[model samples]
Target chain A: MDMSQYYGLFISEAREHVRKIGESAVQLEADPTDRPTIDALFRSAHSLKGMAASMSFTAIADLAHKMEDLMARIRNGLPVDSSLFDLLLAGADRIGAMIDDLESGGSGRGDSAALIARMLAYSPGEQPAPPDREVVETSPPSLVPPGEPVGTTAGEEWGVPKTVRVKTDTLDSFVTTTGELITVKHRLALLAGSCREGGLHEALRDLGRHLRALHDQVMAVRLLPLSAIAERLPRMVRDLSRQLGKEVSFTMQGVDMELDRSILDLLGEPLVHILRNCIDHGIEPPPARGAAGKPAVGRLSLSVARRKDQVEIEIADDGRGMDPGAICAAAVARGVISGEKAAGLTSHEKLMLVCQPGFSTAPAVTDVSGRGVGMDVVKHTLQSLGGSLAIRSEPGRGSTFLLKVPVTIAIINVLLVVVGGMTVAVPLTAVIRTLEIRRDERGNVDGEEIFFLDGEELPLLTLGGLLNIPGGDGPGDTLAVFVAEIGGRRVGIQVDRLLGHQEVFVKPLGRPLSALPGLNGAAILGDGQIVFILDIVHAG
Target chain B: MMFRLRERRFALEVDAVAEISELLPEYPIPGAPPFLRGVVNMHGRVAAVLDLGAFLGLGTAGRGGSLVLLESPGCSLALLVEHLERMITSDDVGATRRGESRLLPVELVLADGMAGLLDVAALMDAVEKSA
Candidate 1:
């Protein structure tokens, strides 16, 4: 019987098995006696071998068969060692390549002879010494973070799946349709306001509530777990530490946390860059760590927390923290800034200088971080997605990189403000507070306007001036303003008037519009007017 | 398609014409170049409107004209033409003349006179570079 129809299914299922084997191998390396992970690794390999055999892909079957044998040996009282993980990972990677070849219309054939031989000859005799007590003490608590325990299948009954696989394009169109529906609903609400019929008003209110519920359900379907892109990060950390002669105890806390798939898609590269930076420059060699009276194994962690409409991802490492003075000096030397300019910057701003292009503190270029190209790309990527990146570090306590991003970019709540007779929007996430400050409350110091809020002095800037428009002339008894952080400084932006807030569907700018700076996206108002969303953080 | 931005006439290939419709309400794009008239909500998609008169240094395009939306992928841009003269096939024009500027290099010979064949791709590129 022809099996061409099953090729897509076989490839997808085979890919899943390969991913599971890789993930379980990494977990087993961290804890050798993890029975569930061992069982998972063995089962995935066994299933892969069965599928490859049925499909007549002998090269893949041969490699998986060897890996299954090795897992069985460990299950049958054979000692666990470092060689076992290397062999299993190599087998999974080889099978993965074969699967890729198959997807490209090849016969799924590859040269796996050396890998198969390694798996066949694997043993504990030549294994290095077992993990020392110090290393074991520093290991992560468990795969699951506290307060969220992993569920077990032992006590649960088997039932039908509660989910189904829908094409990503279909899901995207659902969001678009839902967003348009919301827009139409708004149009209806606007039209209904002119009529004084009580029944029409009541029905419009009900439609609004129903649309909100629909939006929630659609957004939930679009969310993908952070683990979708974070699965292979552990293996990467392992390989890099081994190459750099360093020992790192890496733990990830919120892999199960869900975020929009669009954000997740762009997130993988930045996460990889950050992890590489942590291993290459942030963490020190074991010997250097020992000399500094720190633990021989450095600690690195990635944690995620969801704020109202945003998510914050924190990547921290316990290694040599950056020296703000050194960074400022380097900036001066690199001509990225002047000596006088560097002297006036705060420590936080000094650290941010690392994100400037062509700024590299690394003494020698290596294959790892690629000459300080990591942080800037991270900052740029987050900014393009309407996000921000912040850094904090001490002299010795290590450094943390904080990344905050919106949960989804499709629809958002925006504060509508009239700037120069033209209505514009500021993302609610970017606004700290809105105030009607009295003219007497403002102070002019050194030719710059300043205002005090909560005892913190913030510079006052006109929104119209920033956008190169007109009408910031109202310095009357009171001024309308909104506070936002721009270039690491809190500034009160003066606008013509505050027109309240509304939820609108965001549409990405294309071509000439996309090339324009200082705008995040465009949205249509309920009255059929288009408003440009201001990227307040990055706007000039 | 032949269109007039101001007194000057320009022509784009019919294959690249997505839609020709009456001008819609437009919102100003902050910090954008002067040639970029603004953005308009075309159906549900937002498209940038380029004033050809302003871009070519002719003059600001007069309002209340038609918008010629281009069918280019990844670019939702419309040209604010004062009037869409009519659709003309390539057979009706002679093109072997390359002008100084690549944007309007090819010219079409109509019954009245010669009209420049606008290179939509080059125009988009120029907009990107300047914007």
Candidate 2:
């Protein structure tokens, strides 16, 4: 049977179960005798095995089979031990790695004999021979245990929107339809103009209102709680804390806040990178924490909240904060910044220097965190999604990485610009300010068009000249200058007119078109007009 | 299957045509290649409206009266042409083996004119490279 079609469902569900199992395993370590946690862990592992077996991914199924057996022994009053903890975690890690392999089109298999043997070693004696590794066959196999019923029990939470698993394609198509409806709404708004008051006008106005809400509902259908990813983090921090010999506890608040799954998925690597760095570098060792007059247990908090059109995720640590002097010194040594400039940097500026590519204060490179390429990647990832990263630190306290991400990618606020009678959409997030250019303010100095703005001169290029549209004279009598900050560099775009600002739907310029430079994607205006949104960072 | 760029005529395989429509309002994109004139709204979708003449290095004297929309898997763009010509039957066409642009080989689709058949798939690659 062709299992390719089922791969997407299998992978997503398997990953969820893996993350859930990891969280349960971490909890089991804290309280080995917690029956509920043990039961949950066993149930999750068994489900994973069944799912894997159904997919014919033997290695993952086999490992999960062993893990289920191990958890069963623990449930049967076996002596609680730390070795079991390591075995269960190792099993999880192997399965996790295999899933990663399979996701990139490899068989979800790995050499798990050693891990299986170790887990089997933890099983208590006096047990009957384990059931034959049954390759699961599903006519309609139940995910829950045989005796468990379908309905939610009394303890389960309620009042939340009931959600069902949908193929991503279905959701994408729904979003696309809603986007088209948005354009139609704009078209109707323009049509509703001529006749000020009539049944048709009122009807169109009502339709517009309802369509706006409908668009929101459709977009919200793709949103997932930030906790889906955040919940997986306690396990990561637990493992990292152990590896580093640091007594740390990860506490999260506002886990119920949600965002588009697309953003959350893209956020995975950068979040993990930051969280790992926090444990491996930011948090101090237990003895050091005690010596420094702080609690032996380190605390890292990840909080998410909605702020206007953006969602702010703050990852904070209570370990030894960043040392500005050390950072400045590192920046100097790496030639990222001059020693004199480093000396003049504020504490915040010095802390931010770590985000500069090639600037790292890590004593040496290690497998876990501190590999030199750190904040720069984090900053770049966030920036690509119309997001920004900010760092705050106190030398003796701790550091916090603040990630501000747009709420939705469907609609973006933009500044509409008219260049030689052609309109272009510029994301407002990247736009610093727009100024009118007078003849005296801009001139050619050393063969470069320079716009003198606020005591500093910046290289300026006409928007028309950039596109080779055949307009815009060198020394302008009057012009509109759009100063946008891209990757921390200022770029002045000279255009003929400013067509005001708007919130517009930006479409992804799939493969062929996206590869073309300067254009991020395209957007449809209120008047059935299409404009290209500048990928400002890539424009120059 | 028939299109015009200035006075020159071209033929597109019937399969290459997605839709033919009057020229829609287009917004110019700065920093794009010369032939990528601008973008236009196609129904509710945004399509790159390019001057096929300029793209093929044949000047159109800078005019666009109609658009011939084309689509390939994962990509869609429009050829901004002067206007659409009357449909041509295959029986009225004369096939020539004479050399054509390697990127987009053409078959003379008309017996009495220089109108040549356009290979859209190959032209997509050509446009991608130029873009």
Candidate 3:
């Protein structure tokens, strides 16, 4: 069949159906008696068969035909087993490879006869093998992966951009260019301000409006709902926990929270690391849980919430919580810290030690996950995103890793501060409150500055002192204190001058430069003055 | 396209050149190595301005001058130059191959002096290695 024109439609729709079956299979495994999910899985398999038949992709159609038959019986209340999941997953993998082969201009064919026979062998109340599989069928796939719809053709009918398949790099460039334009607008604003020409001022104002709108649209394009990166967690948790011989009930909140695609992509690894750690180190085995008078099934939950422009992600595992005393001892033995220093360390600081690059108490997952790395990578990744990660654990309870991250990395609203003759941009969203501190409000604790903010005493650091930049209009009796949240703690950053706020585009500090401790990148002011954007997440 | 850093001259293909702007106010990044001369806002985009002299071990000589913005698919850098000397077509610049190296080692022989032409890909590798 000459089906050249329909390849794109067929490939996309077929892949969606393939995904539907895999995800539904996991759901059905979780609740074997879920009638709707079973029906949906069968429908997806059937849709795949019909689509493949229409494209004359006999190999795909044949495998789907058997899968559909198997699911249909399972839908009819037959007992399902893990072996069934294994077989279905294997079938889905093979079908995926076949479609990929076809997309790359090869015949959409694979040896599915073995797979077909295996499904037939496992089928309960086996009906006689049908003589003829349906062919030349073009009805759209009836089922979509849960939370998304792809049943009818009506979505394509609308003129609006239903779904755009833009390469990430394309969106990146668009964002970059928009950032450049915003910088230009700043320059124009400066020009207008200096000249004080009425016409130019109005023109500049109009330009600012346009640029702001453009920036919003560009940023919106970059923001992807968390579900894009999170959809497979349930399946992963189920598979990994089962493989580890542990019982876990995984739950997620705010799955629809959105973040920049770039940030979200980098986030996946850190999350995977934490989740694996939860199963291997944090979560107690079923016997241990029962011994502790706890539920046999371990509970691991992820909650994501947007706090202004920043998103906070919390991964909590109700398993074996960390022992701070043991951590301190380990740190001391590893020469990570002195015995005296370890004794002085706060509970939070001791927990943070687990994320120190070479710090690990639990043996690495050298077998299944093949990940020998620890929480340090997670901390580093968060730092790079102008974010911070903190861990909270109770000895007999569990551990929760909190990550506070900026929602968008491309553009930011910052409170620019000048310290030691250098201008630095602090993300405004990170700033909880800015205050004018009177001399009475400032005090010293352990020779370090402290401030009473909102009825709480918090440690304060001079921006200049932190950067080791000398000779800033040194701290005055009355100071401007910026309270920023980092790593689940509050810090007061006292700066020499408050340069007010701005919405600026940020670029990567790039490679070696990016390695610099607390600076994310640079932002240009209206007068073309470059200011380093501070990584308050790390600094605080 | 050609520009000079201190007394040394470097040449990049015209297409590699994104824009040229007079020195912008640079905020010194405290912990960065000497080769990286902080960052400058090129329009709204923040870019790391490289002191080629420092990278080549020539020592960071000039700070106030022009920036030659260069970008590839995944990388972008602002080459800090002492001056925007002049633009010469690839044909006009007498090029030479350093026979020993597989990578391009073209030197553009200008009227007054010779400017070493760099392979953008290799330069990117150098930057990545620098990280």
Candidate 4:
């Protein structure tokens, strides 16, 4: 058998085993007596060693064998020490580097001899003293079920091959072809309306139904669980907490929630950035937290919720929270915003000031966040994906970073509104609700036109004026507007007319047009007219 | 390849030419610079059409023109020219005794007259910076 043909599979599986070993090590560190986690860590190391031996990669196999031997010792009633977990993590990292080398077409050769020697010489009875910090009463929950582990699904044993991998480009093309079919179906429906003869309308309706089914199936195939991107997060948080010398308990909910694979691909880095911010800037040291009459250990959590077509991911931390006044002062001192302008900003807006480019409230720059450029990139990335970031904090309480993103980026529902004869689309995620308010119902608040919706006053601004387009004068009776949230406030965007709603395939803008701000993408309508999808949060 | 954009001729490398087609109906882009002639649905992909004359600070390339689509996979962009003159071999280009112009990349002394060879990549960089 030509083992060369199986190199890709070997590298991929070996990586999964390595990741599992690291995650299990972290879990075992949190609960030293957890029998299932200890067994899991042992199994992962054993599996990795077997895989490496089959591939004849001596360096990797040697390192994995040592890790397996250590895990065996721990499984056979040897006491678990903190340094043992570090040794395990070190072994995982060394194997990870070797796998990376192999993936890059180099020999999986690395100098793990020192690490192996350390693992071999390790004695579980020689326990080191725990760090001088107040240990919390509660331990963080296990990231995944011990029986299933992080990388494996039920019935997906090694060499069993219950599922096959499909290339991402093939999936992408399927979406593109399906989207084109939907557009053609709409065009046919338009033509069918004119011909009352035969069953053209009925046949077109059936075609539309079948096309909708195909579109739904394609989108469903593109959906992947959030756990796919979140595989390394638990280990990452654990390592960073130890590095920063902070006793923090981190937990996550809704990791199994599914989202578009494309969205998940871009979302991982932003999620990492937010988590880094939480550990670095949001959480305080044990001494400071104790001095503030809080628990010695800080609590950090990420909770995800799906609402309609959008997903809200909230990352929260219980520590010495943000002070809006201090952030405002920092923005003024950095010349990011004028002092006069900062005074008029709401507390929520002041919290958002941390996302401004070149803005950092950290007293001194650290290696972890450096100059604090991550938040700005995180904000820009979310906005580019037609999502928004919001911050809520109290001076002494915790702070929460809310990220709102669409479920999928390929095809989405949009409310078509005509602005200045030309039509534009507002992604349904951004639209709160569409309304028609009579002229008499309008109110003037602080010399600005406002509309009352559900007893809440929202400022009304014309879409034409916002886009600098002309000829969007209303009928002088009722104003057609849709409520959208911008900067944590609801505003009524007035357009010429409402063209109802439709599901359109989104195409990314190319070149100079892509460089333009406030536009998310372009979509072609049934009439072959191109309309720009408004990034409503950034448009104004 | 040489093309005319408002009487003044501009030359682009033959290898850079993906396609040459008559004008397609364009839709206006909101919040875009004026020089952007808007976008067109090229096949199934959307391509931004730039009025080369206006972008070069001459004037609008105006109503009727041919689109010179660039062969850049990353950017589906096209340039509007009034008329295409002719395609010249690389030998002709190399044999030309012309000096590089400070305004554009280089000035190619063609059989008709002196035409500035448009560097699409550099032009794209400049456009991105300004836009």
DockQ scores of the candidates: 0.77, 0.37, 0.40, 0.76
Candidate 1, which segments miss by more than 4 Å at Cα? Answer: A1-8, A54-56, A126-160, A338-340, A371-373, A487-489, B6-9, B93-95, B105-115
**Ranked candidates, highest DockQ first:** 1, 4, 3, 2
Highest TM-score among the candidates is held by which one? 4
lDDT of 1 by residue, A142-202 (tens): 2221112122236755455565557799999988888888889888988888899999999
Provide TM-scores for the models: 0.90, 0.69, 0.82, 0.92
Q: Model 3 in CAPRI terms: which quality?
A: acceptable
Regions more than 4 Å wrong, model 3? A1-13, A54-56, A76-79, A99-109, A124-181, A194-223, A335-341, A369-373, A439-441, A474-477, B1-27, B41-45, B62-73, B81-131
List fnat per candidate, in order.
Answer: 0.86, 0.56, 0.54, 0.78
Interface RMSD, prediction 2: 2.3
Q: How many backbone clashes does every candidate have? A: 0, 1, 0, 0
Task: Rank all candidate structures by their TM-score, best first, as comma-separated numbers.
Answer: 4, 1, 3, 2
| Candidate 3 clashing pairs, residues 3+ apart or interchain | none
Q: What count of clashes does model 3 give?
A: 0
Candidate 2 segments whose C-alpha is farther than 4 A from its true place: A1-11, A49-66, A95-113, A123-163, A244-247, A284-297, A319-365, A369-374, A412-503, A510-521, A532-540, B1-24, B30-36, B47-131
Supply candidate 2's per-residue lDDT for B57.
Answer: 73
Error of 4 at A389 (Å): 0.7
The ten-residue window of minimal lDDT in model 4 chain A covers: A133-142
Looking at chain B only, the TM-scores across the models are 0.93, 0.87, 0.84, 0.88
